[model samples]
Each structure stands twice: as structure tokens, then as C-alpha cells.
Target: MANSEPGLADFTKHLRKWFETRQLSSETDYSEKLWIDIHTLFQVLAKGIDSTNPFSEAVCEPDNPAWTLRSHAAEFKVCQRIVNIFLFMDGLHYVNNGDWQQRYIFNNEQRLEEYLRCMLGHVALLQLYGDNCDHIELVRTVSNSMDPFREAFRHADISKTCANMNYRNIQIGTKLIGLTMARWMEQLKGTRHVGSITSDKPVQICNQGQGTNTKEATADGVRQNGHMPIVEMMEDGTTDVVKKLIKKGKDMTDEVKKRLIETVKDSTNPEKTMEDILDTVSKCTAPGNACVQSALESVHTSVTPVPPNPADHDPSAISASA
Candidate 1:
């Protein structure tokens, strides 16, 4: 834990430098140094998240000056998670620019789709941190900033219109971190003092996941089938949540499938047969449907949209596609 002391110090230092400098600057600065700074800052904060409690207060050193945004570990951690996603998706927007599109159009037409998926993942992760007012405020800010991206993604000709239109999307993303820090500063101005050298919040492991207590179950350090509770898992390197369903190698039997179809039929409109439901599902699952594509793209950035083949849409196509 003490090893994190220097890292935390470095984080606070760079954070102050980054915000104060950016606040004073008038122009949009996207230099290599700028990105390197962002990368370094995000790395440090992310590392701290693994070693420190995100929701805990960062106690400052007695003699050190106060830092605004570092008031809570979660503030910077949430910032890192959301901003990193924006930056990663920045490439898609950049490449979509009219000037670059001619020469660097995606091999497929799903780049915007992929970016939306990253946004969803960012939102989902934010939800896991619990809804503190600060977190709510952060989410609201992000939602407002992302409105344009969402609107652009839903356009009829999204691929043609979704170039982020003059770096607007990335600019919004850039301002988000600064805006978040500013809000924190304004809120804390006369209220309380923050510390530069801070102690991490104590970890509290308790009942979680389906609201069940696990303290007594693990009192003797016994393993529950060699698996720690999901609540104990850290976000770093946690890819299981993002895994693609197809890769799980699970299959649905025809009988079970028929039962599900019957259930759906019985529950809603009995007049609508299994074929009707399959038709609707198939259409939604089609790679070319804008709504379907938008959702799929928002979740899986790397997934290429397969071109629709006429032959693949036959009556049995539903089962075959599944």
C-alpha cells in the first residue's frame, strides 16, 4: 500500500498541472505531449483504483495544499474510465472526417456503431460505482456532452454524417475532464479543505450481489468452489463482462427453443405464430438494420458488420442464422 504513496502524489501533481494549464489555454491542444500526459495520468489513477477505495475520501497531508478533484478517489477514477473511452473512440471520429474519409474510410460502415458501443460500456461501468451525487453529476455531464454523438449516430446516413463534424465530439470529450474538475472546485471553494498527501479509504467487504451476506461464510478463509464473490473482483483486466456470447459455446435445443417461442406466442398474441416472431427477430438481428446495427456497434467496437446476403434471408434463415 505504501508503494502507492508516490503514485498518488504523482497523480495529484499531474492532475493539478493538467487542469490548471488547460484551464488557462484558449485553443484546443492535441499535441503528442498532451496525449502522453493524459495516458500517464489515466494510468496512475487507474493503478490507484486497484489499490485504493474509489468512494473513500483522499486524506491530504497536514502541511500540504488542498487538491479539488482528488477529493474522492472515485472522481478521478470515473473520469479516467469515461475519458479513456472517448479518446479510444476519438480515432473513429477522426477517420470519419470528410477530408480523411476519402482516403481512410473504414473497411466496413460500422465505425460509428463501434464508438456508440464503447459509450454504452462506459455508462455501464459508471452505474456499478453506485449513485453518489457526485457520480450522478458526472453522469449528467457526460450524458449532455454525448447527446450530439448519440444524435449523429442515429442519423439516416450516419456513416456519411458521423465524422464528429469538425472535431466537435473530441472537443466535448476534452472539456469533460476540465469541466468535472471545475465543478468540484466550485463546490468545495469555501466548504472544506482537501489534502495533497492523502490516505486511502479503508476497504469494507460486506453483503453484495443479490443482497446476501458472505462474512460468516468466509470466516475461516474457506473457498466457495474456489471462486471469490463477484463483488470482490476488481475492474482491472475484467473482460468477462465484455465477452461475446457466441464464444461461450452454449447451444439451445430445438425443444427449448420451441418452448420459448410458444411461451412468447401465448403471452402476447396467439395469432402471431413462431414464424412471425422469428421474422421479427431475424430482421432485428440483421446487420443492415440501422437500429440493430447501432445497438450492436455501441457494444462491440471490433465486430465488423457482415454484408447482407439475399440467400441468407430465406424462411429457414432464422434457424440457420441462430
Candidate 2:
């Protein structure tokens, strides 16, 4: 129990206290406050779904902060669960999002869809199962609820939409749903902040995923014969990892930023421009990816609109005609 870690001890204590409070018989009947709050937060997040990140855009300051939209993604799940207790368990509020289709853009007839999805995600892994499924059943109670997951799995195009199932049809894919659940579990299990720091430098990325600067730190560590290399790299600006990656020729154009603008296309607001897309991506680079991507963004967004029922080109007919 390396509870000595900076934020670990507090989380264990918070979990113990939260679960213990839920176990009390009286606690069950007290109120559904948490659930209500989470639903409200989802409403807020829903607005930002039209943007790349709702919570961060709504909350975080957009200066040259050490963090970016990724930080908001990290915080979203944990905050949602806490909000859920207030909404459903406390009865201080109820779990609902109005006009699921109008809100979700798929089932204009289903208002509760987003609300249901949020609640489903939170409670899906609660192990309370049969006992805790009363609300879950409401989601299942939709005319097509029994096969909602399947319908979403078979019909919905997920990669182009929010993994949370926004902007697209209610058809979020099965794999997307599972991955979303896994992220929730990771949060509940509290796996993000666990690890030992071998270096003395100021390392920004705690979760070393796609866009991490690990190479230079490791090299510096080897040459200096200590973790100090890592620390120095992290603190003093030895982004040798970035240099190596650049040399290897991988475009670190902050793919997340590019994807962010792409998400706006399905929005009901207006079509996205390529310039805006490239502009957002440019913001991600240390010096900004201005020169390289300026034309690319313009060209990317310059796609010509086609009629919904455009005539299909028959390859065989064309070849025969030729």
C-alpha cells in the first residue's frame, strides 16, 4: 500500500468514505442528490460535445497552461460519478435529459437517451446488478430498449462521432461502448495516479499514452547514470524525446486537436471550415504548426458537397462504354 504517494492516500480515503456512506440502509433512502448533479453536468458537457471537449471549454482557462483538453477528459468520469449520487440516490434531483433524439440528434423522439446513457455508464459496473437496475430498466424500457446496445452496435458509425455517443445516431458501436465502460472502470479503480518517479525533473504527462516525451528523458537518465536525466529532461527542457520523434518523422501535430475540430462537423450549428480545423491543431504545438498545416487545413476542409442521392458510377458500365 504505497499510500505514501502524493494523491493516492486521499483517494483511498475518499473511496472508503463514499462506499461506506452508500452502504447504510438509511443512506439509500436519504436522497438522490448525486444522480441529479451528474445529469446536470452531462447537460453542460452535452453543449461542449459540439466542441472537442465540453468540460474543459466550459471550465479550464485557455492560456498557455501546462495542461490542455486532455486534462478535462481525465477529470470528467470521476466528476460524473460524484454528481450521480446527488441526482439519483439523494432524490434531491431526478435522472433525466429531455427529448433524447432532439438532444442526441438520433432519436428525435427519445429525450431521455443522453441522460440514460450517462446513468448507464455510471451504474453499468456497479455490481449492484439486479438490485440496482431499477433505473437501468428505464433505459431498457424504450420501445427498442432490449436491443438498444445491439442496434447501436450494428448501425451507428462511432469513429467519426463522440465515443460518448454524441453527434451521430444512437448507434454507438459495441466496441465503443465497451471502451467507454473500461475508462469508467479505470477511474473507479483509481489507476491514473499510481507510479514511482525515477527522475527529479518536472514531468507533465502522468499517463504516458500517445503523445509522450519519454525518449530523451530515458537517454539523459542513461548518460547521467541516474533518474536525474529524466528529471532534468522534464524540468529543464531536454525534450530529446520530441527531437527523436521528429527525426523519426512522426507528425506530432496534436492529433487530438485535429480530431476535436472534426467533431464539429456533425454539429447542428454549422459546417466547420478547414482553416478553423488547422488553427486549432496549430495551437497544440510548442511553436504552433503554422507553416506546415496552414494549407493542409484549408485543403482538408475544402471537400465539395455532393447531392444526397448522387448518381453512382458503375465501373463495369464505364469500362464497357469506353
Candidate 3:
């Protein structure tokens, strides 16, 4: 077995270390970019299947007799591999960010074994096609493209971490296409609204015209006047993580706002100096009032509050008083 070979084992170990270094480095944008490559690889395999469909008449044009063989190779090669690879990389990314060694991998020995077996089975299928389909160009290309990924899966041994995932309360499978498909669909949902407004926020109506429309009754009938269309407010867009962070800090935010407005308005001092105003405003907003007193006192003394002009008062106030 290749697993028993010391040379291959040493190479795999070095490869893992290299992967770890790249994963940990700030300069490397690996996960998302690698995912895109995985997507392209799946597309290549799918296109291969369609191009080499055995039952389709389209394959007759310069096609070989091994169309069915190539189709089978493409289908099996792409069916569960793409999702499993994504699950593997994403789960490893998740686990590597925290201390979940015992929980995700080491504790589940039997599951790990099953995961490895399934991955090896897929890799073996690839190797078989590579050896037997030398005459088929599409299979050759597919096999060559998948070779590195197949080796990564064979040597990484993180299948169990991916196989039994409880992401979003749904169990993922490494061998089946349905369950893994559902998993990615659910994961994609969290990012679906990125750079878009949230749907739950209610639309705000705005009046766009200068005056309100009026209806008048004429001698024969009632006439209605037309008004401008209402404009809607833009909704706030945010991610799930940003939403959680905002929710967690909401109470603190409200408390700080309340303290700030109260500090600004709570001044009852009869003195009309800038120091007096700053001192009052800083009492609740500043930490340890004694520390900021010198800074407050040194502030420009020329800026004083101007008395409210009586003419600027609303006409409703004068009418109410009368």
C-alpha cells in the first residue's frame, strides 16, 4: 500500500507542513481561491460528461467508440468528489482556527476510518481510468487535473471531520451527492445576501412632490388631482457575523448614547463659560473626571453659547401662548 511506503509518507508529511504554513500566512489567500479552482475542476468534469455522452447523437462527430466509458468515468469522478473536497477544506479551516482536535477528529476513530476508505475508493477510481483510458483524451485531462487533489485527499486524512458534519443541523455525506449538495446550498445561503439589502426591513415611503394633492367636486362630477410617486429608503445590508456583533453590542451602544445626551443636557450651572459647559458634558462621558479636568480647562474660552433669538422661535409657540 502507498500508505505503508516510508518515502510517500515523508513526502506527505512535508506537503502537510507546507499547507499549514500557507494556511497560517497572512499573504496567502488560499481557501476561497482554492474553492474557485475546485469549482472549475467540477465544471471541467461535467463538460466532459456532456461532450462524451454515449446516447447523444452529438457524440458521433469525430468521437471514439469509448464514449460510454468516458461518460462513466466523468460521472463517478465528479459525483461526490467536489463536495467532499470543499467539506474537507472548509472543515479543516474551521478546526484549525480553534482547539477542536479531540472533538472533531481524534474522538471519532471509526468515522475517520470510514471517511478515509471512501476517499481512497474515489482516488482508486481515478487511477483506474487513468491506466485504462489512455486512448481517451478527455479522461486523460480529467485524470491529470484531479491528480493533485486526489493526492491531497488521500494524504490529508481529514474525511471523517467532513463526513459527519452537523452544519446548520444537517448531516453531510462524503459518498452521496444529495446530502453534500444540500450542505453547500445551505452554506451558500448565508452569503447569498452579501452586498444586498436585507429583505426583512420595511420600506419607508417618501413624498417627492412640493404640495399635497387635492380633490374638488365640479358641477357634474368629482375631480381628483394626481400626486408625485413616493420614494423608498434604502435598506441596510450586512452579514450574519456583523449582525451578531451588532446585536451583542446593542445594549452597550444604547447606554453610551443615553449617557452622552444626558451629559450634554444635564448642566444646571448659572455660569456662562466654556469650561463650565465642557465640565458638565465630560462628567458622564469621560472616564475619571479628575483626569480630563486640565484638558477641559485649557480648551478655547472664547466659544460661549449664544442666547436663542426670540424671532427664531416657531410661530406655533407664540400662537399657543396667545
Number of backbone-clashing residue pairs for each candidate, in the order shown: 6, 30, 0
The full ranking of all candidates by lDDT, starting with the best, is 1, 2, 3
**Where is model 2 poorest over a 10-residue stretch in terms of lDDT?**
313-322
lDDT of 3 by residue, 1-322 (tens): 0233343344334333333444332212433332343344333323223221211222232233544545454433332233333233223221332222212222223343333323332322222121121212232233233334436444343432222221111111111121223223333324421112112222111111424321111101111211000000011111122222223323334444333223322223212332343334333333433223333344334333534435321111110000
Between which residue pairs do clashes occur in model 3? Answer: none
Query: What tens-digit string does per-residue lDDT give for candidate 2 at 204-264?
Result: 4322364545444433433453211112222222233322222222342656334433333
Point out where model 1 deviates above 4 Å.
1-70, 88-106, 111-119, 122-132, 145-322
lDDT of 1: 0.29
TM-score of each: 0.26, 0.21, 0.18
TM-score, structure 3 vs. true: 0.18
lDDT of 1 by residue, 113-186 (tens): 33322332232332233223343233334433443544554422212121211111121212222212222223
Return model 1's CA RMSD, one decimal: 22.2
Cα deviation of 155 in candidate 3 (Å)? 21
By TM-score, rank the candidates, best first.
1, 2, 3
Better of 2 and 3 by TM-score: 2
